[model samples]
Target: MATRISSSFRGLILLSFFAYLCLCAHEAEETTETQHHHQISHTIPVISLIPSNACTSSAKGSERKASLEVIHKYGPCFQSKNYDEKVPNHLEILLQDQARVNSIHSRLSKEYSDNNKSRDSQVATLPATSGLPIGTGNYIVTVGLGTPKNDLKLIFDTGSDLTWTQCEPCARSCYSQVDPIFDPSKSTSYSKISCNSSECSQLISATGKPTTLLLYLRLRIRYKYGDGSFTIGDFSKDRLTITTEDVLDNFLFGCGQDNEGLFKGAAGLLGLGRNQISIVKQAAQKYGQFFSYCLPSTSDSKGHLTFGNGGVSSTVKFTALQTLSQSQSFYGLDLIGLSVGGTQLSIPKSAFSQEPSSIPARLSKVCLAFAGNRNETSIGIIGNTQQRELEVVYDVAGERIGFGKGGCR
Candidate 1:
């Protein structure tokens, strides 16, 4: 009987020790308990095991500036009529993420030697019925569209340029969404663009194709994403509300009449890319073409998407930004150095790169949020999983990208 009690007490002690380690890993800089491992060559960075901002919610920079909460699509905050929809497993998420990355490589080939002259064959062509961007990942942000301002959940994407949503009178077909399909007829400010407008000409640069004309000479667009998804719809302008006070009049967007893709029940997507049609460019005058975001670390936790430079953090480290020659929408950076824990890894600077998840107890079930490239020439993509807790700033007017650690909202 005494032996049984001793064994049970030992089990409890082991469990308590594990719990303590987890708490320290997330909440504190160092653990009171020591760890010894045979395989590791150097000490693991305990400080980086779990970000300090996990599950924390706060607002910083610009009370009047436009900042919105970003939530995981699979998290508790997302509202959907279809509760029966199956949540994707971690493997499914990895596959979807890989597909999105592959599409990016297809759209922008890695070989930079040839002067980008007839690169259409190497590209993922978007016919009217052909494309919708990416896997949409796990995070989504809600936005107000139209004059009366109907709230729409959109996956804000830095790789895309056109902001679009599923619209009413689904002339052909529309996907199921978390919010009501935006009815343009009900909005007083909705207006369609003409096929001959200069804005329509810009569509060629944005989507890799010319705008098609509808029956009334109204412009229509067809966009194809790298992940084998596509949207076909009317090109129109309306009042876009970032916050109650921050609104953009005559905001251009795609009213997806025939939309098909894995948007994960989002109404649509908001483009934060660098082209003239992107929200970042359209709001250049008011927001100074400056925007920053910090993706949250966990599925249930929340981060933020902030526009304009008001009340900006002083700690952000700036790096030069270079546009990819293959696609103007994609951004490239020079990855000259890498540091893990407190020590810098001795990697070569000329290994030359063009482009760059969750928690578990025992840490056994944890999956890597990063995907490996097929070849050295394959274009590497930096997904939200890597951007989690990173304060990423896009200084378009200043022509740089900045990063700071431990950033969350």
Candidate 2:
């Protein structure tokens, strides 16, 4: 009896030893993954805390305000316009986004150096597809561009300072777009800015390229993006109608006669950068320099871009904007840390960097949306995934940015 009991006890002990080994091995695998994410960029993690019935969660205490319908290029709105979504190569997208980041850094650096030397200089995505979106895409909004109102769909960009579109009589070459190239001549409100005007000289700081006289009166300007795409055209102003109640006149914009870039069938860009040239600066008096936008977390849901503070909810959280550079053209946020599965990541604060930089990871497989910039000294962009399903509000007058959840509903 004693011998039998000893044999059973020894067998039980052996079993426990194996189980312990298995647990250690499993933990190592997990450590490897966590380390992978940690090592990739030394950043942290952000998990979606979206509650069920997100619409109720999103709208509780928040007013449903509308101004411009912000749509994904691959969403139903663009498809209804007969514009096909651009096929995305994820690796390529990352590379190009990095290029764009590089361009922005270069522009900001030059602007900063010029300021220290004499002051003032110049500067510088898609997620929709097959249920597989890029971290973000060129979000578009429609607005009227002249008398008789040529309603144009523009890629509303907070990173860019000049609102521009392809114009009629493509003086050089223009990319094909869904809307008819804006016929500036047909618009009674359209007027070309002269080379000698103060506004024309402002283009020097805006585009980071000096204005040149194509003729004694014509101010021809060229603006290049980090993706190696560019626009060379006339700098002009026209009446910009955002909504029936929110019309802005004398809105300076680019009439791209020689526009080259993959805009994915949108008419052009709407600049909302942090300078006097941005629409935010141009329309500050009417709207109080306040605007907010929500990118839908899913394709079926809707997102919006409104120009007032009427929709702010009580639950919204605000983060102070950090000046990562001298130009201050883009929205800056200090992403001090990240967390995973409710645990804060143990890493340096220097890791967090740009637009909504992540996607919800899948089960049993982790693919981080963060990428390392060219160098650690590079400026960071507000990560797109970081803003997923949240309302991003810009209070330029307040000099602080805010976010509210449940916005996609």
Q: Which has the greatest lDDT?
A: 1
Question: Where does model 1 exceed 4 Å of error?
Answer: 1-56, 61-64, 81-84, 110-135, 208-216, 226-228, 340-371
- Among all candidates shown, the one with the greatest TM-score: 1
Q: List where candidate 2 sits over 4 angstroms from the true fold.
A: 1-66, 80-85, 113-137, 205-215, 339-362, 365-369
lDDT of 2 by residue, 1-409 (tens): 0111110000000000000000000001112111211211122233332222222222322244436776555444455454455545547555545544554556656667765653322222110101012223346678999997999988776766677888987887887677888999999999998877788766655544433332347676566644455677778899999877668889998888886654747787777777678888888888888988776553334567778778676666776554444456656553433455545456543444544535454565454545555565454443454455666778888977776766555
Listed in order, each prediction's TM-score against the native is 0.74, 0.72
lDDT of 2: 0.57
Score each candidate by Cα lDDT.
0.60, 0.57
Error of 1 at 65 (Å): 2.1
Candidate 2 lDDT trough over 10 residues, lowest sum: 10-19
RMSD of 1: 13.4
Model 2, residue 33: what's the lDDT?
A: 14
